[model samples]
Target: MNRKVIITCALTGAGDTTGRSEHVPVTPQQIAESGIAAAKAGATVVHVHVRDPETGQGSRETAFYVEAVDRIRESGVDVIINTTAGMGGDLYLDPHDPTTFVEGTDLVSGVERLKHVEKVMPDICTLDCGSLNFGEGSLVYVSTPDMLREGAKRIQDLGVRCEMEIFDTGHLWFANTLVEEGLIDAPPLYQLCMDIPYGAPADSSLLASMVAQLPEGAHWASFALGRMQFPWVAQSVLLGGHVRVGLEDNLYLSKGVKATNAQLADRAKTIVEAMGSSVATPDEAREMLNLRPRS
Candidate 1:
């Protein structure tokens, strides 16, 4: 078990959870504030995803990213920033015609999805290891091998760390292949996403299986959605990995108590302390992950 663990708070995700809980931050200012609050609450890292201010749906606007990132940097806080590059890959296959792309489809090249990442220049950016059926029905998240190579090359050139997000075993396998090909740099970072529909379930055995396959000297974190979020925090620490929690993965701190990003981070801090292990600060996390110096 890791004696000291790092906590990453995902501020908001690309899901339609704005109406589900009023605590979800919509505007750029709110997102930045939420991130700052989480950082102050003991989160070493903050994962950001921009949402449409008017609609509360996932948006890829570079202007929105600029505002939010600028706010975080100028907040006098020390949390590491991790921007999502998992957007613009959602594919909605029409039930009537397989060849006809549906209206909800936001398909784009892997490099195209990093438009905001390039402009904002966060400390880290997500690189989803592989594609799979996102959920039930015909909807799928497409990330071909070639697309991944393109994204990885560009991300490497930019001098930003890539957090490889593995949703399934196959995805993990392909991610290792990328490492073998030297696409991903050494001491790679991985985020084991659990309980996402049609992917790896939120089970102990499954998480163990994935953890056993990680590359040597990998810096990693794991999280599950909904009620399993907090439990996974303890589990990740026990398994020698870090933890992630926030409104993006779980909305409720308890059965029905809606939680803000700060509240979630606070609870995670409690859990980590209860287990007799302390949470790492941003500078500590940076040293542990061997992060590149700020530009």
Candidate 2:
């Protein structure tokens, strides 16, 4: 097993998790502070997703991203910033009237989604590789091949590292296609998202099968939602992959035990060290991932 593993803390996801866990940061200040705390707790990178301050719902507002990034940079933390460019692809179609889009639908062109990333130029940006059945009943996250190609092109043009997010096995095929098409840069990075409904399940066999499909020389990490979050850290490390943990993916230290982002990072760090593996610092991670050094 690789002893030096990079840990990424997904501070807050674009989900309705704030109501469930009081520790999930909602505002720009809270999100930025949580990022800093995670960095100090041994997270080399922070995966960010902004939410509406009032409703606590996920949003793709440029102002929110600007404020969050500014606060994190100003805090003097040494964590690599990775913003979500996977929003604006949610397709909530009406069940009866498929032709009519739902109220929550935030469908936009792939290029539009990268607007914030173009402006902020974070160390890394995520590109969700494919569409999948989100939860149940007609709800789907649409990421067509054309859209993925377009997004990958824009991300590459910005000179930012793209963290390809694979939700299923087919998504990995699409990511490999992007690499073949030269849309993604060399030494690709991937995030194996597991245990989301209708996607790849969080299990050893499935994780191993997914890991085995990774392209050669690719840097990757894996995370599972809810209870599987911490356990996957050890599983990923054992499979020669990196680990990601935070309140976004999970908010509990145990059954009914609430946890903050920093606390989660600390717990993951302890597990990594106990497994005879060390956490990679921000600078070291940058080097390994070939990311542009943080200014």
lDDT (Cα, tens digit) per residue for candidate 2, span 16-126? 788888899999889999999999988888999999999999989999999999999998878899999989988888899998888778888888999999888899999
What tens-digit string does per-residue lDDT give for candidate 1 at 1-295? 8878989999989888998999999999999999999999989899999999999999999999999999999988988999999998999998889898887899899999999999999989999989889878788999999999999999989888899999999999999999899998877999999999988999999898899998899988999999999999999998999999999999998998999999999999999999989999877877887777865
Model 1 scores worst on lDDT over the 10 consecutive residues at 286-295
C-alpha TM-scores of all predictions: 0.98, 0.98
Q: State candidate 2's TM-score.
A: 0.98
Alpha carbon lDDT of each predicted model:
0.92, 0.91
Candidate 2 ranges with C-alpha deviation above 4 Å: none
Task: Compute the lDDT for candidate 2.
Answer: 0.91
